[model samples]
Target: MSTHTPGEDVPVRRIDRILAFMSLGLLVLSIVCFFAIMIGSASGADMSGGVWPLIGVVVYIAPIVAFALMLAVLIMSFVRRARANRGG
Candidate 1:
């Protein structure tokens, strides 16, 4: 007989939620920046003032940051499940 309820769902940890959101947000930001750069280049728009530099950096950096955050989330989740299965 199973001790757990079939309909029960595990609650997400606060850190897990925050990490997931941050990772997703960064991924989206990187994609938008990438498209903006592509369109700007295709249209020969001046891309050297105001927020352009910041956007360029984001296009390169955001995906890396997001990947790292996602890796962290995965590791934490693995540890949590391991502990739970161990009856900790």
Candidate 2:
């Protein structure tokens, strides 16, 4: 009773793809920042100095925000596809 045939590819929206890419980029940046912070700390750099801690906080938070956005985009895409399939 399915409209789609077996082995058919499901189409993804452009916005969803863009959000996914953005999320991935944010995750990569977060990881790089984490390593940089660790190395800096190990090298006796003052984390509390000037803007370092602020940079650290923003980097740590970026992935969470990016992932949330990506999740929203994915859910919206899924709902839109479902509605379309239902002939709404």
In order, the Cα lDDT scores of the candidates are 0.88, 0.80
lDDT by residue (tens digit), candidate 1, 2-37? 796434445689999999999999999999999999
lDDT of 2 by residue, 1-88 (tens): 8776444445787888888888888888888888888899899998888768876986879889888978888788778777766666
TM-score of 1: 0.83
Which whole-number lDDT from 0 to 100 does residue 38 have in model 1?
92
Highest lDDT model number: 1
lDDT score, candidate 2: 0.80
Clash count, one per candidate: 0, 0
Give the clashing pairs for model 1: none
RMSD versus native structure for model 2? 2.6
Clash pairs, candidate 2, are none
Q: Which parts of model 2 have CA positions greater than 4 angstroms off? A: 1-10
